[model samples]
Target chain A: MVRVTGVADETPTVRTIRFEDPGMAAALPGQFAMVWVPGGGELPMSVMAGDPGGAAFTVRRHGPASTALYGVDRGDLIGVRGPYGNTFDVREGRLLLAGGGTGMVPMMRLAMRVADPSRVVILMGARTAPEVIFERAAAALGEVVISTDDGSRGEEGTAVDAARRLLGSGRFSAAYVCGPEPMMAGIVAEARSRGVFVQASIERPMKCGVGICGSCCMGDRLVCSDGTVFDGDRLAATGEFGAIYRDKAGIARRY
Target chain B: MGLATRVAGIDLAGPAMLASGILGISMDVFRRLLDSGAGAVVSKSLSAEPREGYPNPTMAEAAGGWLNAVGLSNPGAPNFANMMRGAPGVPVVVSLVGSDPDEFVSMARLFEGLEVPAFELNLSCPHVEKVGLEVGDDPELVSRIVRSLKGAGVRVIAKVGLGSSDYLGTVRAAEDAGADAVTAINTVRAMSIDVHSGRPVLSNGFGGLSGPPIRPIAVRCVREITSRHEIPVIGCGGVSCWEDAAEFLLAGASAVQVGTAAGGNPGIFAEINSGISSYMERRGYSEISEVRRAA
Candidate 1:
């Protein structure tokens, strides 16, 4: 059992919890871990920090596990297994990281790894101002840009729209995006059109983080093992990501 | 040793195999099963065309186990054939589902010159649209599909569901249609409502139920099918432990398929296999075949 050592409300619906597991805190940024809330269920969450002994996860209260997680105290015990999947490569160049909703978790970690602060840009979006998380934290990392659907704060329109405006004026070597499926899909498309190397983080309901359950399979790729981070070109090839996912019976449905 | 169990000349290390539907879809996961001691790994059901499957909330837990409507989402036979090429040394069983006989024949032919160990005709997927056992329920259709794959040279196992009005009749139909064996008890059609929103748990409204809840029904169906037919019966449904597997064997199943139980515990195959070996050892039985119909 891992002990929770820190908790911060990133948004009304999302919170970043830091664990006191020495092994987890040392996990790399792009890798994710599975948090089991005992009776609730096990869920895969990306590492929001590069510290192995002090791992963190930004969770949105959307399901049972997350809901129960929100009730956890700083000293509460939670089960964690991993540092699984691949991480973002923060090589030298003009890097642009776009995050929307809860997708901002990993991007915040990526922002810290930018070798050159001036070359890094973090673009974020949300439905409203209250939903925006880690604005100050992200600004401390690099140039932070925020967008909201309701124009409650920052620029009006979606995160991709804001990214387009940023791209119009600057030349970026690579782009990393994470958000809802549609948001990531749109960002990946726009980034590809601009000839930027794009790696996007994907989410799926996963049971076994080791790729045995097959619940998180996206086309030829297994999201848990092959990726939660895939380049634009690779993401476009998997027919399931932007499209529909089927049930056990062969019916076309959404994720 | 009573009788050696061999399907199409392929020696099964044991009589228990991890069925196709449950986490058997991914090559990595399939490898894990082999590492965990599954005699064979059945691939997830594949179709003639690629499918996206159903939406969110496709699986839900019930009183005894899980219900899922994962809509046989696959990468299509063409792509699946390529994936199968990289599989481990264990026998690989390819499961195929289709709406009509032509579709089944088309999928089977795709693997025709390939090295697949066996083919399981999935006539019993409960979540698809007008395909699977929904159409397989027609005895004539089952006959036609099986007949079309007669000389495929690969061992053919006709996988069917329970709760059908004419369960024995359907098994006979598949045998008459040229099935080399049969896998009993796919998921049972079930549904659940979200008490708060008053909505169905699955996007498909209803899903096939598996786990301990369906074990008795599976045993009953296997008994009926194996007693009446000359073909080997592969008992499936809610097999969680060696005792459950042993019960199916006593009921006359030559082999058994582990599904929902595997999802909860990946090491279950090894545990069950070990348990069976120990039970057989104590009883002075040297082979798994000796336990079949031991009752």
Candidate 2:
């Protein structure tokens, strides 16, 4: 069981919950844990770098499990298992990270892990001003550019739009992304046009965080094992990457 | 010869299959496993309606195996049947679970156009209520389910497990009702508790255990079922290596299914197939049937 040591509001509905877990801390930037709320259900949360030798998960207050998790504060205990799935493969030189809402968690963590922090450029996306989270934390890691859909933040468009504009202006060694499927697909396409190496962390309805359950499947890849983070070339090859995904019921749904 | 063999009326390129609940349901995954040398693949058990299954802590590793209470989450028959559209000859066995005989037969018929080799009647799932072992425990219900499916012209394989009632009786009922084959043993009923938390590890409190720990029990059940009835047996549980596969075959299982182990090694099918071929050559056995005869 992991005890919450601290909680901080990232946005109106999002909170960053901190806990000390050696395995989770050691996990790669894109991996996640299956956090089991005491009496509630378990949900997968992306692993984040925490202060004083611990790990953290950023939760957006929605759904029963996430709401229960969002309300947890200091000393609250929750069952956590994993550090499961693949991670972001760090590359040298300039790196571009783009994400929105809670999807920014892994991108922010990846920014911190890069060898040359100053070379990391992040395009943080949100719907409005208050929803743009961790701007200072991201800036401290490198360069942070915020994009809000309503034009209340840094840029007056989606991260994909901001990224597309930036792609022509500069040469990034690689691009890392996380967000809604369409958003990631857009950034990946932009990155591909510029011949940039890209990696994207995908979110699937996961039952078993382990590889056995087919709930997290995308195309032929079991997201829980093959990757929560997949390379640009790999993603581009799988038609299901941005097109079709399975819900908890195992019914295919288009993004 | 090669690792090729036959289970009931179905032809298997190898004797190792991808067990249900382990990356099952996708015809794409079945094709991948088939390409990787698996004999066949079983889809996760499906009911009349889709099930979301139990929440997390559904699986816990303990006591030399995995304890799981996934609650048989699956897309209902219609959705899965649609997924199988135009993808024939994948050699997948559809596994069905429900509260009664009519439910099983109705589900089997949904895949009529898919050429699904058989429906593996899941009468042994250990965690769920009303169905699974609860229904399997009643010999009358077992007969009715198998008979109904057979009457609908659906080839069936009865998967038996250790429940409160005699497993032998379950096998007998399935055989008498015209089951094509029997998969001896589902996961063994088991649980694990966290000492510090003073609570059960699995959400269901208790779940079914699979992996190295249950191999002997599964082997014993297979030997017993094969000896008592004419039903061919497909042994499941704790089959991680070639020797385990060979052991099951020698004990009279026509095919072996791997679950827990394959989660880590997707190449297990190819590994087991090669190992079995080596075992047959080393033992001077030309046929899989010859190995059973030697036993």
Write candidate 2's Cα lDDT for A136-233 as tens digits. Answer: 88888878888989998788988899999878776788899999888999999999888888999988887777777778877678888888999988
For candidate 2, give the lDDT of residue B291. Answer: 79
lDDT of 1 by residue, A85-188 (tens): 87876656788899988788888878876745688899988999999988887877888888999999999999979988777665788889888888888888
Interface RMSD, all models, one decimal each? Answer: 7.8, 1.6
Deviation (Å) of A106 in candidate 1:
7.6
Report DockQ per prediction, comma-separated: 0.13, 0.58
Q: Extract clashing residue pairs from model 2.
A: none
Q: Chain A alone, TM-score for each of the models?
A: 0.93, 0.96
TM-score, chain B, each candidate? 0.94, 0.98
Candidate 2, after superposition: displacement of residue A160 in Å? Answer: 1.0
Model 2 off-target regions past 4 Å?
A50-52
